[model samples]
Target: MTQVRVESPLATLSPELSAQKLLSRGQAVGGVVVIATVVLLLTLSATVGFGPSVLWYGQFAVAAVTVVYVAVIAFKLAMVFRADGSPVLRFEPDDLHAIPDQDLARYTILVPLYREASVLPYLVERLSALDYPADKVQILLLIEEDDTETRAALASMELATQFEVVLIPDSPPKTKPKACNVGLSRATGEFCVIYDAEDRPDADQLRKAVLAFRLLPDRVVCVQAELHYWNPWTNWLTRCFAAEYATNFSLSLRGLDRHRLAIPLGGTSNHFRTDALRELGGWDQYNVTEDADLGIRIARRGWDVRMMVSVTEEEANSRLGNWVRQRSRWIKGYIQTWLVHSRHPVRVWRELGTKRAVAMHLTLGFSTFTTLINPIFWALFVSYLITGPKYLEPLFPPLSLYAGLATMVLGNVMMCYCLMNGCMERGLHRAVRAMLTVPLYWGLMSVAAYKAVFQLLRPSKRHFWELTEHGLVSHEA
Candidate 1:
């Protein structure tokens, strides 16, 4: 006997499918704009040269800048390698045990959610399973008041008694930092940590952090746990994203801490001393990258932020469009942070000391410049290739060209080494694949960089939060 099965109406028209279609349309538009801009720039560079000599001069200038930028990055990498002679912190298998019942401290875990209903269940389960005492931990699910759907979802959860929901009042410049501030006001813990909705932090992440804090002195005001992704194999985009983060958090940040420079706070699993944070007025609402901005402020005020050896796992954006949106926001925030700090450079130097101030600028300021100006280099390169020596003569002579090429090659080698080191540290099985995607990763970054520049120019036009979807990994499995 044959039976006919009927499909549910809602199953035929899934909301997830609809949202993905909308996202794809937006991404297509963005890609078109980027392609158009690149074409226009290349055409202008080729045709607008006043004369052969002038064209060569412009090319020379571009080559010189590129060479200098690469050289600086290479130098920084060398310094980082030399400074990290030994591990500043270390963790062992036993460190994964639950926090001692007698020694548990009141810890606040703040998770700021905005239109994140899809991943809320996974986030809740991850938090509930942490190897910390349920009674000692206070998990605040910070949600914007306008996000009623997410709010209702939280209400439906049979959450532990320790879990609570805090609604952020609608305010101008609606941002994550503001939501964190609302959570901060209601927090009643000795220590606090920030986690995003997609985080699947190690069960003992908090336990390890607590132990480190107790061992260190009171001056250590914040502890940043190492963050890595669990789904690097999802696609090339995810692989590259994992590599980039591994280098940034694992190598660059740890090196900065070794040199006693201001280490920018990463977005998640950053445990803080509640008193210290409250004293600084929580996070700066105006700074788009509030985590980085707050880290610097704490350092300048004579507090220290340390790095925990423990690692937290999170999802990497697997889709190209999602990756671009996430990267654009990061670049935009970096630009905002740079402007805010550079407004009074001399004063900042005096407060943070010359060495620290220079380090901060080199890392943050140089990062922003490198990303924003990357497309210019590509444009000039394409023009030079098309027009041959006629277009290249004005930029640089043969000797300078050789020097530029050498510097670029050396810089890339160094970056590759750093990325490989990150992959090995995180136990990534496909390190070679991550290395191969470096160029594609850079191309995506170029697209995001242009978008970020546009956003910076008309900051008022940037309002919507391009939230990256999570829940790609299942906890039960």
Candidate 2:
């Protein structure tokens, strides 16, 4: 039997909504306006003395915003412990038993692979353990046309009856989202999910997601399971990575859910209503962080994305170089998502309402901005500490200097505190000690942020997907 190739033009489906091109016309105009405004302010500042310069007031404004953002971070950290009940959907043993086999919806599992042959056997074993009815599920291994290694590896394996191999035709923009779009076109189920090659999800995750969707409102079209690492104790890098994921998935996202804000979908373990996903045009193939982009689009269309209490354990990148390569791509995609969504702010506000729109910016745009500007603040603080605030007085002022100091010191402490609590919540107690050294992880993130910025500036590298090699670390922890 022969399989026909299928694809979706998610990135370009709507020219105004896609990040296929670096910048839309509206975004370009917006960028120009922002630059011009900054230039005018700087020129006015140069005309005035440093004490009362417009730039000084501008610095004050930024510092004030930073203070507020830090406070929000602190609040989210607090929510990690203080929230009365789980903000995300949680099911008991009886809840799983309540849904009969015949009542379950047809499911599609898409695992897009490129040069990931090493993990094929383990991936298959783990996926086969899923609790869904075997006859009702369709498992698609989306391999690229040119990935001969993975294809040859699959050829030798005796796959289950429900498993099918989908060879995505060789194409430009060889990204995971593009392969996923291909799989989405061929999905034959009421619900669909994407799992990476190295993921080991809880056996009943699919069932939990199905039940969650049934219990939630019709507008809730997606359920995101929490993502943690299978090898959190692999090394310092992996430990830090685990702590970060704990904070992100457990605290930050759940906090957003509690407040009815937009929740960005994780890279894997995101289950979606097939029809709703297709209606949203799948994912942006050109965007490196397609999950984040899709999540925003879901919010913009008045749809809700909820988090399920299930877990998907992935192999964290333990190697430093591999971690940076992966993180840089993520940060780069975040930049792309921010720019793509910020093109039409007015329409977004009208669609998502004022609160959601603001939340989206704080989630996407402002976070990216903060990551990019963090080094600048760090350098200034270092200078302040070494020079005793003498040379930096003009720029910082007395009040602004203290405010900036407070934001820096308190923000890092709150983040570290959140990570520690996140570890405890997830039962990664050993990783709690590593949270103190998480600042080193932040340094790596800044390194990745700069790399992402450089990649965004270069046309050829903008959409390049840096592959993170898996199957190297033992899953002992």
Candidate 3:
């Protein structure tokens, strides 16, 4: 069989989807104008002694935006209650037994590794447990050229014939998606999925994904499995992380699917038709969050990504520094994905339609915007409590004050309730208590969001992939 040399097809196939250019000329100009206008307003207000009046209107604008954000969250919570119409697919035991070993589709599993030697053994064990025929399944472990630690670890292991170690060439953008592209070129399977080093997917996940593909319409080319932490009991951080994942994978993603909106896929456990993935250009090598970008591209091409009922348990970042490092990269990737897609608004609007186009903006653009501005709102609330609302009251008139108050009161209440309910639904009762401290988690997110913005601004650091250290927890719960 001849091997295909696949590169970042975004440059050739669709330059609009590529992250090669961080921002288009139009977007940059618009951004500069907006920044200049804000600066001019502040300067004029300070020099002309009209700062109070400018702040008064600014407060009302913020209050209105907050209402929209809270309303979106409320919509997600409502979707959780209406799960019967969710696009998540589930299969019974009988469904699995009905398929014979000879009839199963050829499946490929790609594991991208970088300085993850510690978890290599665990990963191999998990992959070995996948309930698929050995002859039909192909396992490819993608390792970077300079990653001697992982290479040495794999060399020592007594591996099976189905397992092959694929060395990625030294490249400029040394990213996971780049390595996965090399793996995709060599894949012989009909369907493929990407998994991180510390992932432990359910034994029947691949089979379930195959069944989902067969049962769904031909337009559905990918199946995304739910991801949650296996070590939630490890610490306060892990517990909080697990709670967020519970809501994200189980509720929020389902909401997007129900609405036929573009689903921002999780990093691991996304199963794709091998040919469809290749045609879509594998993944954007320049984008840090390649998975999210691919999900949007899938939707833009008129291909659908369905949610599978299977789960993949991963080790959460147990340390604060590690968590922030990982989060900053993800946030940075979201920024990249948004900028890449927003380059041609009219085309995107036409392709995704009004509803999906708006959903994409809210999911990627507005969510990141909120993370960056959350600190301002938090500081204002603190000031209101400290100095009494005397000076602030003028800024927030009766209507704006009530809306802001409701956002402060009702927003937090709804979010916390969603977190707790997500935990209860997922049988993660221990994590329910950690939901109360989610405000603290938001502070951490703000720190990461700022870090992401800083990195995004630096040309040298824009494509840097922050490696999240795994194998921190000794054992899983």
Candidate 4:
């Protein structure tokens, strides 16, 4: 592929030359278990009048944590509201007319796979139909060395000149990041992006991303385009999934981009500068949510991420078991990322700055923690309303009790309103009614969070990558 706009080229650092990637088998799980055990014992001792003279200290500690959690949730809701008030920078076809075709950049595209042969043909067709110059675009079809079935399908493809097959050696963590790293090692373009086998990116997405890179400051090294499902109306489940994604991409992430805060990149369609990516040693093969971990790493190193106006359509997992497996892996990865960064709190705080460090905790840490523990609080809140106030009243003082009532009213209302507005704003009008069933959707997420925590604690499935089956529906959004 022909290269383009190689500015201030930093020397590429090979995998062998860089420090070994951190895999999350022993570090996070063991450390987390020890911390949890100590906290539990302290709480128990306080309740039994063995640790503190101040009779209410232990219960106060728990209440204080809950107060902080609710406060942050309210703050996040404010960010979304503020984002809606601000203007969004959108690119249209007229804007794309300024750049000449001769000046267009070459971009390397990677599609990592394990056993995705069933969808290879549709993937090839979509990639081939991208609006960018064909000669400047090179797709690296990455397959594991042992995946003979996918390899056979690749051999049969007619667009041999448009793509190249890269065989990755068998590795301990058979993750998407590992395959992406192998593809990155062989990438020959000035800019690069990744797409799953089931994605259909907007035709002018590359152009908008290229323009964003040229127009934005040098510190902005990556651009994330919007991701939404194509078959949003396939079922009730898919509608909720689509609404959740729409709110995150269009509303939540826009705020992060506006304030120059780092956002966890979506798994696909994140365009990056080759030199900057190499400077950071590529993706972490150990972290399940490598995109998010990499985003935080970029911010710590004094770089920024931006959001593009274009969209990439993906297949929504319609099946219950498939959605649960995928969601659990994602939540587990977020936990891994939080633990790895929190290991050196002082260093990370100094590097990421107070504002971004807090944002990172709210984005990664709070999400996993809330999902894992929401059920317990929900039970308490429900009991207070349905059964009687006598059940859990003594635990919380007046201030904490008032705050809990406020959060319950404000949080649930904000979430439902957010989903409805997000769907309507994105022209996904069909999903608004699905908001009525969102509480049930959240319950399922908690179920996945429990599974994620269990898997992270266990020794056997710590590194397992449960693949989500795609190509179930063939609709275009």
Each model's backbone clash number? 8, 0, 0, 0
Q: How accurate locally is residue 390 in candidate 3, as Cα lDDT from 0 to 100? A: 87
Candidate 3 per-residue C-alpha lDDT over 22-106 given as tens digits, one digit per residue, 9 for 90 to 100: 9988999999999998778777877796555577557757677776667566656665665557957988878987678899999
Residue 121 of model 1 has an lDDT of 85
Query: Positional deviation of 234 in candidate 1, in angstroms?
Result: 0.4
Question: For all the candidates, what are their Cα RMSDs to the real structure?
Answer: 10.7, 2.4, 2.8, 4.6
**Which candidate's lDDT is highest?**
3
Candidate 2 wrong stretches, greater than 4 Å: 1-4, 7-12, 40-86, 475-477
lDDT of 1 by residue, 1-477 (tens): 111111111112122211112123444577689899756666666778433443554665666676657656864685457546524567675764444666778999999898888888888888999988898988888877778889777767788888888777665557777778777777788999999998888888888788878778898999998888888877777777788778777777878778778878998889998988887767765456778877787777888888777778888887778778888877766666665666556777998999888777777777667766766666767888888867555566676777766655776677777788777767775865568558667777878878876866664735335577666555442
TM-score of each: 0.83, 0.93, 0.93, 0.90
Arrange candidates by lDDT, highest first: which order? 3, 2, 4, 1
Candidate 1 structure, TM-score to reference: 0.83
Candidate 2 structure quality by residue, lDDT tens digits, 198-291: 9999999999999998888889999999999888887899888888888888877887787777778899999999999988988888899999
Better model by TM-score: candidate 1 vs candidate 3: 3
Clashing pairs in 4: none
Cα deviation in Å at residue 358, candidate 1?
Answer: 1.7
Better of 3 and 4 by TM-score: 3
Off by over 4 Å in 1: 1-64, 83-87, 93-100, 462-464, 472-477
Clashes of 2: 0
